[model samples]
Target: MNISISSDPQTIAENCADVIWAEDKTSRMLGITRDSVGPGTAAVSMIVGDEMVNGLDMAHGGLMFTLADVAFALACNTRNSIAVGNFCSVQFLRPASRGDRLTATAKESLLDGRNGIYDVTITDQSGRRIVEFRGHSKIVPGTHLAAASGDPAAAEV
Candidate 1:
């Protein structure tokens, strides 16, 4: 999906998210859908399928983490800068079973220069929190998309 976005940060951010959703094959394979993306925030959702269940019939912890991670990645990248995950931790609060639709919401907690901190909460459709995640991001020197296109916006950051 080709998207033409203006040089503004918010537009760049939204375009970056579009690129992620279009290019990230792993996210596609997991059936993750981006519900929303804005500056410093993102929400993503996925349904627990039989393939995601463990022997105990509960959703695997890794899949839950991945859901939260995707939200975190989208939130942090919204600055129009290329931000990569430096560290992340997750705590499982409840077990999710097959057919449960899980949503992960990420919010930026802090941003200091090139470093940023984000918190993500994963919840079931009923709004019960299932997992908590914290992610640290490091902003790199280039924009994810504009840099590739030789746009001046990439150099502004």
Candidate 2:
């Protein structure tokens, strides 16, 4: 969990996204991409691949969940604190198929002390809702990045 973060909020958010993409091999293999990251929001996308299809000839639930989870992780970690998901629930509305590009957008709904709630919406390229995910997170005591070299002010986000 030793990652390089930035003092700037936006840079910290971007660094979190980069760290996620670097650390999560499952997300990388699934073709997940971090589209954007902000203070309390993140967007991730992936194209449904043939290998990701399930027995039903549709995108597997696990893949969709991973995409949403990545977005949730990026959104929650923007504060430069190590945020771990405590609970999450996903509701599948429509099945996705190979060649479909899916996007998951996560927005923080509430944050109190170390606890937070995020809502993620997964949609197809056409903007059709595919899944809904709600994630609960808890911020831990450590910072994601160490202080930058020669810059005392670049401590944490």
**Which candidate leads the pack in lDDT?**
1
Model 2 lDDT-worst window of ten: 148-157
Off by over 4 Å in 2: 1-6, 149-157
Model 1 scores a C-alpha lDDT of: 0.90
Model 1: how far is 123 from its true place, Å? Answer: 0.5
Residues 47-154 of candidate 1: C-alpha lDDT, one tens digit per residue: 999999999999999999999999999999987677999999999999999999999999999999999999999999999999999999999886656454666655
Measured with C-alpha atoms, the lDDT of residue 41 in candidate 2 is 98
List pairs with backbone clashes in candidate 2. none
Residues 1-157 of candidate 2 have per-residue lDDT tens digits of 5555456788877776666667788777787887889989999999999899999999999989989998999899987788999999999998999999999999999999999999999999999999999999999887667666776666523
